[model samples]
Target: MQCTDHTVSLDTWKNIQSLGIQCKRTTYRGVRAGWRKQVKKHTNASPPGNVSLNPPSPSVNLGVINAQSVGSKSAILVDSILDHKFDLVAITETWLKPDDSTADFTPDGYTFTHIPRVSKRGGGHVTEPTHYLGRMLDLVISREGESILAHTKVKERFSDHFVLACKLNMNRPPTLKKIITTRHLKAINITDFCSDFCSSAFSTNLSEITDMSHLVDQYNKSLTDIFNMHAPAKTRTVIIRPFSPWYNDEIREAKHKRRQLEKKWRRSKLEIDRQLYSEQRHFVIGLMCNAKINFYSALINESANDQKQMFKTFDKLLHRSKDSPLPKSSSDEALANRFSDYFIKKIKTIRDLFPPTVTSTCIDVSTNICLDHFTLTTEDEVRKIIMNSPSKSCSLDPVPTWIVKEGIDIFLPALTHLINTSLQSGSVPAVLKEAHVRPLLKKSGLDQDDLKNYRPVSNLPWISKLIERVVSARISDFQERNQLQECYQSAYKKRHSVETALLRVQSDILSALNSGDICALIF
Candidate 1:
């Protein structure tokens, strides 16, 4: 049969089969690194190592590309991908309408591919579709030490949308396969391989494009178009889910229920299907969260070198966001502070699971000394505490600033205590002036003028300056109450300490009395 862009002669069909076998072998038992690394050793030349390389042995990474229709947003999304060096990027709704005036795709340094959409016929003039009738998908891939080898289109089911796929030539041919159907196998005089993959029952929970037939038709049509053209001898077809709605609420809930049932049947048939295996064809299962970065290794497995690297990578990815709304009160300020707290927690969790080796120079920031001064008792203790802190779940935004504001109240005391104990800088004024403090004020919806009435200490000259802004009248009363409460708390703590000390002194006096007074009375 003729395939897309080329005739699938017997030789071609054999080639596809061989490629598929090679892929299975490579994925299951290939060398630790990649095909290029072996080539490099043979060539006797080595370049700087790319840290992003997933040392071979069945690991897949998943990332999302939020490229907006506008060129500016697309550039930002592309930059983010390049910076992170993600393994796979599931791009969403790329409004790429190809026409004479526009290029079909743009790959940059990456090899690009897309599934072109076939225009659907309208029933009448009134039924005509606007803009474009067909859906297309674009996939771009780049491999270290490889030229942009394969950039082309294949018709594939991505979701409801078409999927475009690109794979850098890792010295392996792309293999597209079709499951032999019962009818087809009978007609072709074949048997064993026709075992029903659909009724496997083991595959029921797995998500796929709801309409598999439509996807297959798209693939066949694209194959025809590709075969009609004279292109590379190696080009083959693949079926990639156009997109996955795993993040959708309904799907997630359903999966959660399934997971619960699976847990109950752990010792039975479910265990076999649920066990982590390289054979799982799903991208997330097959690649992204692999053995190298398993859940167990991420949490407790921390060595100094690995911990350092994990933090470094995390810090780089934590790019500064645009300015948030200004907070008007201390409550608002606390909410702003929660953003970093939450982000840092996420970093810690991921790092705990997969402790990547990190390095640091002696001349790095001198902030380690400050960790002890905060509410954090010790720099080391702060790791798990801040990482698992409750503030991690709060979202910082102007519209729902209250959520962040509320979380800050819960987190700030813990954070403040940690900072106070570990990194004791008497410069409370300076600390409050930092970016973290500013965001809190903006979110609190309280004005500086409102804070003036709460001054418990007139001696601190900076207190007056903070109260000058009249943004929120409510803050004045709240701050006043807070000051009074703090004063009472301070007094109560001092009183308790003094009473305890006095009691100890009195006990010592009683001991002395026992040693002397009885002898005197007897005398």
Candidate 2:
């Protein structure tokens, strides 16, 4: 939330530019030696008006971003987009790896097609030396789980360049069309109309009723005669009174006592929650301090060579100070000052780089799918960094809705797992270990060894403490350990209530009891 040095952005941008590799926009006429192309041709003809064959409007409304790039590099771009919450992203100029025989589907909840690009075998201008296949662009889509309705690449105005288009069968709402025709109505006579003939024609008829009162009457008389024949000479009637108010009072008191007992039992189960919030605060502070120190040390180590050069410069200046024919101009002093500022600035820049803002923004690809973009920076990492974080911003552009729907179902779970792993282990995920984290660091031109050495201390002291506690308890047979763990769990629940509804309800009672807020109500 606070920053002492904010100007390190200049250096940060410089590192990013120097180290990060930018993907090229390539369009090939035919297949290259190492790439493969899977064709997704469109079946629908061009529609009337300027309606795009691959409509992007629907996808755009779902927060899909329209993008275009070349080849499997485009797929990598999708990975980046998936990392962020983009509803949809489109790529152009795709050059699928020629030798790749596997399906063109992106593993992360995204589906795509590699338009087969074929070429001539000869060494002429159109064809590459080894590959005889042609080149084709693909439509990468994430439409939840829906299939693409159409994907086509059409050449523009006889040009060698092709325009790739894809339409997803995302089962959108339907439109209506109206039809008009003539029909004849039956003719009516004036006299029939005057008699209300039309109303009579449609009236309900009650002419089929049958009588049943005679049978009922005869049965009732026969029953009365039978009863009279079996009647005794004398009959007696008895009445019983209800209990007194005192008896009722006792019953109510007993019920009230039972309610009180239930309430007491509920209260007994409500235990104390003991989570060291103050300790966690200290832990966070220690972790930050350790991280800052490590970062400073690494920076100092990097600039050691620079400092040595400065000393040499100082020595040279002193030697020249005595024999200078004309005194060194004030310009020289200014220049020297400038150089010092620059190097010291470098130190601060490196220090600024230590903290990064960490945030996850979910980009809705469709109604059912979303892309969670995880961003990591020192200062912003601890907070809930939403899409509108000050350091970063996003917009919902037009992407094929199909891509939004299909993309997350394929990609989100894997990404979610990666996020959970990163949170739990405080380490980068293995699957994308090299691709995502290493490449970014490398792109920044940072020293790998220094970065590795400067790794942030893990914030999970409780975990280590717990392990020790468990082992010690096991050796000593300490039942109190179980009690402690239970207390810890209770405290954890109080501190971290489940975000989900059902989970919150189930844990609410226990959480209230643990926090010692359980109130008994008896009536």
Candidate 3:
């Protein structure tokens, strides 16, 4: 990848500080244009210990720097590498010239990877395996759908170093399970699909079936087929670029020219070439700084009028990472067994929280069965629940909330009957019982290795949540109608909070103290 601009100064630091962003110690503003902070590994080791001894970071923040002969900016680059804590940095044109030793450029946590380009320019051809004017397809042993991409740039902007980029999926190995994609959900012909599904599946007996589970299965499969046919999922590369409105083609050309001149100066032993390179370098630096000042000034003006836009601008500067590598046991068999054990233990804990069977409940200070005045869960209630729910993706389910809500008109009777049947039979389907556990990092700046740092998020299907919502509504209605709630109870009740509870306690304490009942208050 070609770099953006190799420009940094006190003004750049002030710009970042004004935005409340902390500057990394050895700023690699030139390492890669607009350097993003590296994701440091979680380690208990204090200062003075070798960083390389620490466990490897989940990712490598690579920066390619061209020192134009290492002596000039060697210290600055070393400090930047240490401060940003880059895992792997590829440096080029160090002007090592095959005679120089590699003592000075090495930093604490890092070791250099590539061989510097040697100049035998006076003698015809270069001996580099891969050069700008060369091509070789570096293929990896990958699965059928997997891809390996190699991109080249005509100009080396950041430094004259050759960019080595390889981005893997980082997802777990592929399974035999049929994957479904819904990339084009909005374009699906829902009305037509529903019309066909109803005709083919339910035309025989219509709504006469007592058991609706079979119908629900047919409904699910039909919808799945429609999705598979219309918007099937495929393996595709997703590149997310930062929002940089000010970076234009003019600056791109200037950076490219400056890099060419730097390379030319490095290769030549002549004084005139060196002078030309120095002059061009200074001109590019001034152009870059001016461009940045104008961009930020415009950004600040626009941001003053819009808070959301300003927050977005702030988020872009931070470039927060959320990649957490999956933890695995030794073997495939071991992993499978561990997962089985975990889910088994988790289910046991969950089951322990509830009674063995569902039973009717009564209001009014009593906790006994009340079959006489039990209300039947209605079809309208289910429809209303689906309608009001927000559209979002669940963990494992292929079906989304919007799809469920959109198809409610066609699937209402089936869903309503299914829910009622589940309630009446004192059981829910096995699908609802199953859940996916995702471990999310508690903070962006925490050790990812320790299990304690992650919070397990239980993701059951949205339909399961909808069922729970319905049940919760009934329980709430019963409590509200019977007036069984306490006045001072500020929990599990709407418009009540810990703040209100604290205020009540504070008032009682103050009343006692004001009335000269300090002893009573203390007691």
Model 1 root-mean-square deviation: 32.1
Sort by lDDT, best first.
3, 1, 2
User: lDDT of candidate 3?
Assistant: 0.53
Candidate 3, residues 1-523, lDDT tens digits: the string is: 3333333554564466579853333333333321111111111112222223222324344444444456554434454454344444545455565555454456532344445444541111121112322242121222333322111112222233323322222332222243343376677677875675566555435456555466445545665676666667665554332123455677668767867875654343234444556567657656655665687677777898778778776654343234554445576576445555665677799899998888878555555644333255787888888887767667555456676677778767766766666566655667776777666767766765445565666788776787688777777677787776687799988789999988988899898888988534342
lDDT of prediction 1: 0.33
Evaluate all candidate structures by whole-model CA lDDT and list the values in order.
0.33, 0.32, 0.53
Please, what is the TM-score per model?
Answer: 0.18, 0.16, 0.49
Q: Number of the top candidate by lDDT?
A: 3
List residue ranges in candidate 3 displaced over 4 A. 1-187, 197-206, 235-328, 331-333, 339-380, 406-408, 411-413, 424-426, 439-456, 486-488, 506-523
Worst 10 residues of 3 by lDDT: 36-45
Q: Residue 464 CA error for candidate 3 (Å)?
A: 1.3
User: Residues 1-523, candidate 1, lDDT per residue (tens digit)?
Assistant: 3222333344554476567631111123343243333323332122334222324323333343423342323322443344334345555545544431112122232434333234531111111011111322222333556443232222222223322223332443232354331211122211211122222332232233223333223323332233223222244444332222112344335434544543333222222223321122233222222322343244334434567556654442333223434325367556445544655666688789974766755565443222122221433343334343333221111111222233433333323332342233323333223232222233333563433222121122221122222112223344454453344232333245666756756776788798885422221
The parts of candidate 1 lying over 4 Å away from their true place are 1-161, 164-285, 290-439, 442-523
Best by TM-score: 3
Clashing residue pairs in candidate 3 (N, C-alpha, C atoms within 3 angstroms):
3-158, 26-80
